[model samples]
Target: MLDKDATEFDGACHCGAVRFHVRLSEGLHSARRCTCSLCRMRGAVAVTARLGDLHMLAGQEMLTLYQFNTGTAKHYFCSRCGIYTHHQRRSDPSQYGVNTACLEGVSPFDFEDVPVTDGVNHPSDGNGQKGDGIIGVLRFQSVGC
Candidate 1:
């Protein structure tokens, strides 16, 4: 079972141009991989945080935002170094999926069986197939918000 508790964590981009602090309330229990057109390319494992759980400690000016498709999910990255930092989940606007590999002392493998979701058939798009034939979807069950 997950710890289901909150703790402070810190992280930054490759060039350290962007830095931020996030509270890991679920301790990567909600960690996952996404296969949206962009996520499939970026290939980063991510964990969840409430909007307030993230605080830009530095380099806010150096952060860039990219929106595509429906434009609901906003992807943020370090403008200076082009490292994806986090994204405002289209699945859940109130929560951000901070990059798991970017966390200060945590590894994506530290969590048991990280799951991947099928963004290509997202429920948000009105026809999600809850794993269908995807690999990691069996573990996650649904592309949850």
Candidate 2:
């Protein structure tokens, strides 16, 4: 059972072919971005969540997993729509990083001053860098209006 006060949010692909529900604390939904090669190419803005907080509301069969860079993280996408929905972050296997853009009500445009993290120097142990640990927060503002 999910906490009654938890912030329940919805998200989907650009073509609306994929959708999911995410339950997280209000302030906990802040976005993050990774500098890894794959993450850079995908332009993904991540919101961390506990594994159990994420629920595949629909289109389970359409989802596909992509693994690379030592196979540390499992990037999940909609196979049919080719949308990166979420991923099991390499830095923390126990957490799920959902794409904030995929969420329904939350527009990337509304975020202000998303923090930047340094992942290029990330720890080689596959745990990612130590200081603050996050590589960056690619908010809508950073992407341009």
Candidate 3:
């Protein structure tokens, strides 16, 4: 988990075509994964950030946007390296789900446990409330160096 005080982080794409700084809404405590079609395929752990909290520092033009299904969520990636960086949440339009691997000094494996949400039957889709859609938890265990 990230230090509670560590709200901000610098991030970049795999090819360095995109760079950004983000201030997490609740640091790594908001880390989660989604079982949605796109998310399941992307297989990324994400932390929450307010829409305005993410600031592009460079290579804005190198970023590409992808939206599908309901088209409420807007996924951004690096055009050069095709690295998913962030996405405006479909459940919460006010927030962005930032890829943990894109952040400096942070990796998906850094989290011992992360909640997995059921995006398939999303609350916004009239399935149920947000927390009620929790699928399960993903745990990471490091054995040896």
Candidate 4:
């Protein structure tokens, strides 16, 4: 059952091979970018959503999962287009970190001051390795629009 009051945002992979709708639990206030080796390379802004808040409207088969390190985190992407869509956060299993850029009419650059999570020293790693702790929030404004 879908919540009538929930805000719905349409999303699709780069090649339109995968599509889905995100019914935000509380709008989109929880967007952030991670600074982990994998995340930094991927370079995508993720917003918080409960596992139930996300609904796969189509292309479930085109989605592929990838895990690394301790395999605690599950990353999902479109197998056809190779576009990362979302992932289950290792820090909070209950939260699904969604690719903010996938949202319709939304661009990572449109966001101002996005907080950076210190994945380099994740508590789950227990490696005693630590990042500077939230390097900073990035701010950007789309130009010529």
Best by TM-score: 3
**Tens-digit lDDT track of model 1 for 1-145:** 3343546789999898899999865767677887889988997888889999899999999989999999999999999889999999998899999997777877655565667788888877778466442446423333444
lDDT of 3 by residue, 1-145 (tens): 4564578999999998899999998988888999999999999999999989999999999989999999999999999999999999998999999999999999999888889999889888887656557789999989978
Best-fitting candidate, measured by lDDT?
Answer: 3
lDDT of 4 by residue, 72-108 (tens): 8899999998999999989888988889788887778
Q: Would you list the C-alpha lDDT of every candidate in the order shown?
A: 0.81, 0.72, 0.92, 0.82
| Candidate 4 backbone overlaps, count | 2
Clashing pairs for model 1 are none
**What lDDT does model 2 reach?**
0.72
Q: What digit string (tens of lDDT, one per residue) describes model 2 on residues 19-125?
A: 88887644334566667678678876677888888888788888898997678889888887798999987767888888877877665555664555565666766
TM-scores of the candidates in the order shown: 0.83, 0.80, 0.95, 0.86
- Predicted structure 1, TM vs. truth: 0.83
Q: After superposition on all CA atoms, what RMSD does each candidate show versus the true structure?
A: 6.3, 4.7, 1.4, 4.6
Model with the higher lDDT, candidate 1 or 4: 4
Task: Mark the regions of model 3 whose C-alpha exceeds 4 Å error after superposition.
Answer: 1-5, 129-132
Which has the better lDDT: candidate 1, or candidate 2?
1
